[model samples]
Every structure is written in C-alpha cells, then in structure tokens.
Target: MHVCLFDIDGTLLNTGGAGALAMERAVGELTDGSDRPLDIPYAGRTDRAIVADIFRHYELDFGDAALRNFLGRYVEHLDEMLGQSPGLVLPGVERLLAHLHQREDVILGLLTGNFIEGARLKLRHYHLDAYFDFALGGFGDTHADRDEVARVAFNTLKAHRHPEQIDLRRLWVIGDTPADVKCGRAIGAKVVAVATGVYSSDQLAEHAPDYLAEDFEAVDELLELWPAIG
Candidate 1:
C-alpha cells in the first residue's frame, strides 16, 4: 500500500491565529501571569517542545505533572479558541484528499506538530478528521523532534500492519515546511512541500523536496506521482 503522511497546521488548514492565541493563553495560565511571551518559534516544532520552551522561558517547573497540566489547559483553551474562531481548510485540500481517498491502494495518515487532540480539533472543525487514519501516524506528544515523529509514524504503521504491506519506497510525507522535508528525508520518503504555510515555494525548494508546489490547487502533477491501481 502507498502511505501518505500529512501535517496539520499550515499544511491541511490555516487556523488563522487561533493556535497562537490559545498557546499564549495557555502559557499565561501556566506561568501565572508572569508576562509569558509568545515570541517562541512554533512552526514545525512539536507541542511538547513548545510547552517545554515556555517552561524554560518562564523558569517554571518542567516536571511531568506540570507538563500534563499545561497540555490539559492548552487543549481546553484550544477548544475555546477554535470554537470562537474556526480555521479554514486550505484550497484544494478537500479535493486532493477526496481524490486520494478514492484510491484503495493509498493509506492516508497524519504527521503533525500539534498534539493529537489539538490536531483533531482543527480537523474536526474543518471536517477533515475523517479522512485520516490516526492509527498509522505520529503526533506532537509522541516526539519533540520532527524526524523522530517520522520514525514514530513508521513504527506505528509497522505495529499495526504486516511488514510486507508497507514499503518505505512508497511513502510520502506531505507538509509545508523545511522540517517536513527533513523528516521525510530521515525516513528516505518522498516529500511534497506546499507553500500554504509560512514558507514559500522557493524556501521549501531550497530543502530539495521531491515536489514543491505553490499550493494544492493544481494537484494533477501530484496525482501523477502515484501509480494507478489495476
């Protein structure tokens, strides 16, 4: 089977500033109004790493309990923020997903930096969650490094499916950042980088992804990458 692992934020959908706003509030709550700043870089970073950075920045406890508390609060705030300001599924995303979903040979999954719950929130809001197989991919809570997240996804796929059913050569990691390219390369998987996120096509092209597009609006080329099933 062909495996396609996708990223959430900036890739499948743009959450407006809802994610940033939720993170700011979560950090503020965790830090007890100690002037927690939202200046930390978030793109392509795992939620665990982001929260850890917030803890270090505020000189707060980074223990398991504290981290759990922070994540719980973050999820709660994320729900509220998403409800208040729902995000948008990027152009051609639904079309691409529908096209791929119609192919029985393709297995769709997620490879994102957002916590699994947060990712679900975004997807559910856009009604895109049903398109993915969560059992086959990785989440932000699984690893702090994006490359390691790729590993986690492969491992998950292996654990759930027979070894022969999965071919690394047939794997594709699709996202909108250089980190996604790095992650795909880590597993020797093909990368399809879209410029729907903060990075432009040129910026992503510098990373040498297998394919780079301005957006998914024209996915004919991308569709051609996959072979037709008999």
Candidate 2:
C-alpha cells in the first residue's frame, strides 16, 4: 500500500486571515497594550511555536497558566470566526481526495502542525474531516518538531494497519511548504510539494522535494511520476 500524508493549513484550506485575526486578538488580550505586533509567520510551523514567537515579540510572559487561558479563548473564538467566514479549499483538493479515496492502495492521512483538536476543527469546519483517517495523523501535541511529528505519524499508521512489513521509503508527504518537505526528508520519505502557500515554486524547488507542482490539479500526473510502491 502507498500512504499519502497531507498538510492542513495552506495545502488543504486557506485560514490565513482568520488565524491571524484570532492570534492578534489572543495577543492583545495577553497584553493590554496593542503596540506589540503579532507578525509571526504561520506557514509550515506548529501552533506552539507560533504562540511562543508572539509572546516573545510582545515581551509577554507565557507560563503554563497564561498559555492555557490563551489557548482556550483562542480556540473558542477561532471556531466562531471560522463558522462566520470559513476559508476556501485549494483547487482540485476535493476531487483529488475523492479519487484517492476510491483507490484501495492509497491510504490518506494528515501530518499537520495543528494540534489534534485544532486540526479537527479546521477540517470539520471545511467539511473535509470525514475524508481523512484521524488515527493515522500526527499532531503538534505529540511534538513541536515537524520531523518528530512525521515519525509519530509513521508509527501510528504502522500500529493501526498492522502491515505484514513496513517500507519507510514508500510513504509520501504532500504539502505546500519547505518545512513539510524537510520533515519527510528527515524520515527518508518521499515528499511532493505544492506551491500554494507563502513559498513560491522556485523556493520549494530549492529544497529538492521528490515532486513539485502548483496544486492538486496535477496530482494524477504526480502519482504517475512517483516510483511504484511494493
């Protein structure tokens, strides 16, 4: 079987504006003064890291208590904002997912930086949750590092599938950022990068992913170019 691991934020959905707004609100609440800019980058990064950067930029203390409170408020209000203005999924994502779903050899999983609950909320908000197998996902809660998350995802898939044998090289990580490609490379997994995020095609190409494309519209072409799995 061939396993396909997908990234959430930029690859599957576009929650950039809503996410920034929520983070800005959370930071504003944490610091009474609005002078601190929440200019932290979001693409290809974990939520924990993003929050930490925000705290650092604002010179605010981020103890466990503060983090917990911020997270609670952020999640609650983020959900509301998403409900009000849900973002658009990338072109051909729905069609590609449906095509892959019908294939017995293809197993769909997520390797995202979002925490499990946050990941679910985003996917569910976009009505894309049911298409994925959550048991195979690796979330930010497991590890803040993307490479560690990739390893966790591989292990989880192996444990769940109980494959007679596992071949690490057969696994594919598909996403829209160099970080995603780097994480897959860490585990010797093939990476397919789509230029739908902050990075351009040339930028992602500099990372040397196994495959590169504009979007899922050419997924079939990508699959054709990928080496056959055992």
Candidate 3:
C-alpha cells in the first residue's frame, strides 16, 4: 500500500492570508485589544505552536480555556476570511490529486500544521477535501511540534495492520519546507519537497528530499515508486 501525508498551507492549497488574518483576529479578541501587526513565521509550523508563541508575544494567559477560546474564535473568522479570499490551488495540484484518488492502492491523509477543522475548511473551500482520508490523518489541534504530529500519523498508520503487511516503508511526506523534510526523517519516510511555497528549488535541495518538485508538475519520481495498481 502507498500512503501520502500532505502539508496543507503551501502544499495542497494556499489560503492566501486568511489563516494569518484569522489568527490576528483571534489574538486581538482574546486580549480585547485591536489587532496588531502579526510578524510571526508560520510556514511549516503547527497551529498550536504558533498560537502558543502568539500568547507569549502578547503576554496572554496560556491556559487551556484561553487556548480553546482563541482557537474557537480563529476557526469562526477563518471561515469568513476564506470566503473573502479563496486562494487558488497551486500548479498541477488538481490533476495530481485526481490521478492519485483513482488508485485504490493509494491512501491519502493530511499531515498539516492546520487544526483538523481549519484543514477541513481550507480543503473544502478549494474542493480538495474529498480527495483525502480524514480518519487517517494528523492535525495541529493538539500537538505543537510538527514532528510530534508526524509521529502521531505514523502511529495511526501502524494501526491498520494489514494481513499482507502494510508496507510502511512506502510512506511519503510531501511538503514545501525543511521542517517537513525533518519530520519525514523523524518517521523514516521518504520526503518530497515542493518549491511551490516560500522555499525555492535550490533552498529545498539543500535538505535533499528523495524527490523535489517546482510544483506538483514533476511527480514522475513519485509515480515510479508507487505506480497505479489493480
């Protein structure tokens, strides 16, 4: 079996600045202050981690209730921001997802830094949600570290226990950041670094992913490893 774990923000689709905007609004509301300049780096990081940092930046309470409220408000505004700015899918994403969805041997799951609801909202907005197996994925709702998120995904995959041995060796982590590459290594999976996000092809090359793409345009390397099957 072939398992593909994908990152959301800059991998499958872009939400323009909707995610960041929603976060700003959430933090502002949490602190009862007007939204200030959001200067945090979010690429390749988990939502909880980012929020924890935001809480620290603003000197807000880091309690459970505060986190829940902040995230709850963030989700509400994320829905609104997405409607206002529905970012386009990156190059070749639709075609690639369609082709992969056709293969019964292929299983798709999200390994995104987005919270589960946030990931679903973005995917659904771009009509990409149908292509993923939500049950088998990991979200950033709880885990702050991306590596922890990936480890959780690895555990979920192990639960399948196919009688014929579910070849975990065939697992692939596809993303656009070095963090993605490192997390893939954390679980001993092959990495496919895409330059469709902030990282350029050369920058991603330094990480030495098993495969690299300017976008999803060159998935031939991946296809060679897991061709469509009967």
Among the numbered candidates, top lDDT falls to 1
Give the poorly placed runs of model 3, Cα more than 4 Å off.
161-164, 219-222
Clashes of 2: 0
Write one digit per residue (lDDT tens) for candidate 1, span 52-75: 887888888787788778779888
**Candidate no. 2 TM-score:** 0.90
After TM-score superposition, what is the CA distance of residue 78 in candidate 1 from its true location, in Å? 0.7
Clashes by residue pair, model 2: none
- Which one is best on TM-score? 1
Error of 3 at 209 (Å): 0.3
Give a tens-digit lDDT track for model 3, residues 32-67: 875656678899999999999999888777878888
The Cα local distance difference test for each model comes to: 0.87, 0.81, 0.86
Task: Give the 10-residue window scoring lowest on summed lDDT in candidate 1.
Answer: 30-39
Can you give the TM-score per candidate against the true fold? 0.96, 0.90, 0.94
Give the runs in model 2 whose Cα sits over 4 Å from its true position. 63-65, 163-165, 225-230
TM-score winner between candidates 2 and 3: 3
